[model samples]
Target: MALGHRARAVIGSIAAAAALGALLTGCSTSSDEPAEAAEQAVEVDPALRAMLPGELLAESTRITVGTESGYPPFEYTNEAGRIVGFEIDLFDAASDRLGLKYTFHDMLFDSLLGELYASNVDVIAAAMSDTAERQADYDFVDYYNDSDAIMVPAGNPEGIKNLKDLCGRTVAVLTGSTQEEALAGLNAAECQDKPVEVVQFDTDADALAHVQEGKADAELTQWSTGAYNAKQVGSGDIFEVANTEIINPTPLGFVFLKGDVELVRAYQAAVQSIIDDGTYAEILKKHDLSAGAIEKATINNQPQG
Candidate 1:
């Protein structure tokens, strides 16, 4: 399963859902309003204020980052129980560039944002897609552009070559992911008058396992996740990448609390500096993920719907 293929399979069904309710949401209210309204609305404690951006990185020597640590080559714990991956490296590089100390906390991918809102962490360096809907809840620093792909058993035994081919086949996806959103629409249409089932898992590994066990016909996921799984499975011939599509090619970036403009600026500067100095490319290559890197962009302050 090539990275592109797995992303396609997972995204195919997800695109169907978007077609049902896919409308771009905006994030701007007024330029004069404080950018921290969302965090203030949540009433984060005073003690946590120091942890927010612009208060001085020295005040808190260690910053905490949250990630799922299950999506390999992006964020995953190694045999030593230390989180390591492309996102992890990016954070490490940023921390080093900023002379800031940090720690990594592994949690559910969907829960990472909630933890940030709760003031549990200072940043989220997971491979989070920067969508307008997500921007409404958090600030993002765009760093990469990722597209969806599909993954199937080698030779695509079911001839599951594309989303249209999945009309009567089972598909696996991670629960709570945008990929699931795509699948919802496909399932409604493709399985509307049939027995097709869309199975969901907490992680890509679990979803891929279901496919390996013959419990499902294929798994859909991010390009990187699909590629990593294919490599781990150790048989390019055993799995096939099919129908690559940019169904959800979103800017991937590090997430921060809504009002942390200073921290976001610092991260943006660090990311840009890395990109300029060639350090960013080195990190991506180190992880065999050079193709995923993208140019740095100003933080999009508008809300996403």
Candidate 2:
């Protein structure tokens, strides 16, 4: 919770973003174009491919994935409207180990689960964490280790540095994120006398906008994402990550439907293969996220038990 590792990751991210933004200034791409995962020379693992369901293989095993690209450094649309991030890189590695093809569909984070339930997609690889509550409807292929964080305007203007400082202040959060649930709980239990105002939005973009516009005092999101947005907006001029203990350090994974045991097994083995071969590590380092890399591939990762 000290954020010793995550904070470093954020700083590295800002340096990279600043460089990228400079070169792409004045250029634009149609937002309608979805960013595809990076195509790399990943050798296919025949053994893992055989573990996949026969029905899945029948269609050439091109897995359809749902994601919320509004979150940066992990999964977000770049200046070219191309989907690029560590999550995409991880999936690219997993697909290689599994010898499969994958596609990404960007949508509201709240609707990702629904799309999976409706059979519109085969997986959700949006840096989603595997929680006990989520386990009721989904299984997961754990890929990254991360935590929650808060973002406030630069220069410590409001002096909201820690969890306690959030009391009586308005904090914007994504509508269905763990941060929203966690912050509300904090309000009810710890800030009863002066509860924090929890403003909800369906998109990370909207939640971030609320804080930048001065309508909210702060925004709660994934630590790396908060850090990414801070440097991304104005090259470190817009916001700064609060100096608080990392909030909910947890595993972020590829969410799968509960009944797809075969598909789940395929991914678990594929993920382990990448971890063993160093492909996973390389991607993490490329995105300045090596600090959150997990040493093992796990399924349905819930730290509680």
Best-fitting candidate, measured by lDDT?
A: 2
Itemize residue pairs with steric clashes in candidate 2: 35-83
The ten-residue window of minimal lDDT in model 1 covers 1-10
Q: Using Cα atoms with residue i matched to residue i, what is each candidate's TM-score against the true structure?
A: 0.76, 0.84
| lDDT minimum window of 10 residues, candidate 2 | 1-10
lDDT of 1 by residue, 1-305 (tens): 01111110111133422332312111111112222111111221233333334334343345656677778888776665556677777766665566555555556666677767766566777788777878887889887777777889877778776676766778898877877877777767665766347898877778888888898898878888777767777765556666566556777889887776667767777767677778788778877888877665557633323
What tens digits encode model 2's per-residue C-alpha lDDT throughout 42-117?
A: 6778889899766555533345667878777877776666777888777777776776666566677887787677
Q: After superposition, how far is residue 192 of candidate 1 from its true place, in Å?
A: 4.6
What is the Cα-based TM-score of model 1? 0.76
**Cand. 2 Cα-lDDT:** 0.74
What ranges in model 2 sit over 4 Å off?
A: 1-40, 59-61, 302-305
